[model samples]
Target: MIVNEWCMYCGECAGVCPQCVIEVCETGLKFDEQTCEDCKFCVMVCPVGALEKDEQK
Candidate 1:
């Protein structure tokens, strides 16, 4: 997962993170795929719409 500059630091993504991959940080919100279970729960809850999965295509 990769959080771009568009991140607004909203915690919505973290709230629903099943794997707790998303976390709010002082610099900004971050998404750690290492802890991610590939469950897109957090991706669906981002209010600022800043969260995104790493495009593997």
Candidate 2:
């Protein structure tokens, strides 16, 4: 997933990830692409629209 600069570090995406592959830190979010299932739940739940599916990945 792609986290844009609009991100507020609210942890909403990490909370909705079924695979628990996303983490919200003090500086930014971390994604475990290796374990991600491409569910896109994080992207959909982002309140600020900061998250998006990285199509190039």
Candidate 3:
């Protein structure tokens, strides 16, 4: 997953991730790509459209 500049740091993406790959902290959002399952749950939950598929592959 890719978090763009549009992120609002609302923690919604972190809350819905089943793999616990996304973490929302006081400073900002933390994403663990190794733990991510490409579930796209975070993308769907992001209200600001900050999260998106890497699409580099």
Measured on C-alpha atoms, candidate 2 has an lDDT of 0.90
Model 1 stretches astray by more than 4 angstroms: none
lDDT of predicted model 1: 0.74
Q: Which consecutive 10 residues in model 2 have the weakest lDDT in total?
A: 39-48
> In candidate 1, what are the lDDT values of residues 1-57, reduced to their tens digit?
767677777688888887777778897876676677877777677666666777782
For candidate 3, write residues 1-57 as lDDT tens digits.
677889889888888999998888877777887888888988888888998888772
Better of 1 and 2 by lDDT: 2
> Which window of 10 residues has the lowest lDDT sum in candidate 3?
48-57
For model 2, what is the alpha-carbon lDDT of residue 47?
88
Question: What does candidate 2's lDDT look like per residue over 1-57, in tens digits?
Answer: 888899989888999999999988887999999999998888888889998888888
Clashing pairs in 1: none
Clashing pairs in 2: none
Error of 1 at 30 (Å): 2.8
* Clashes, model 1: 0
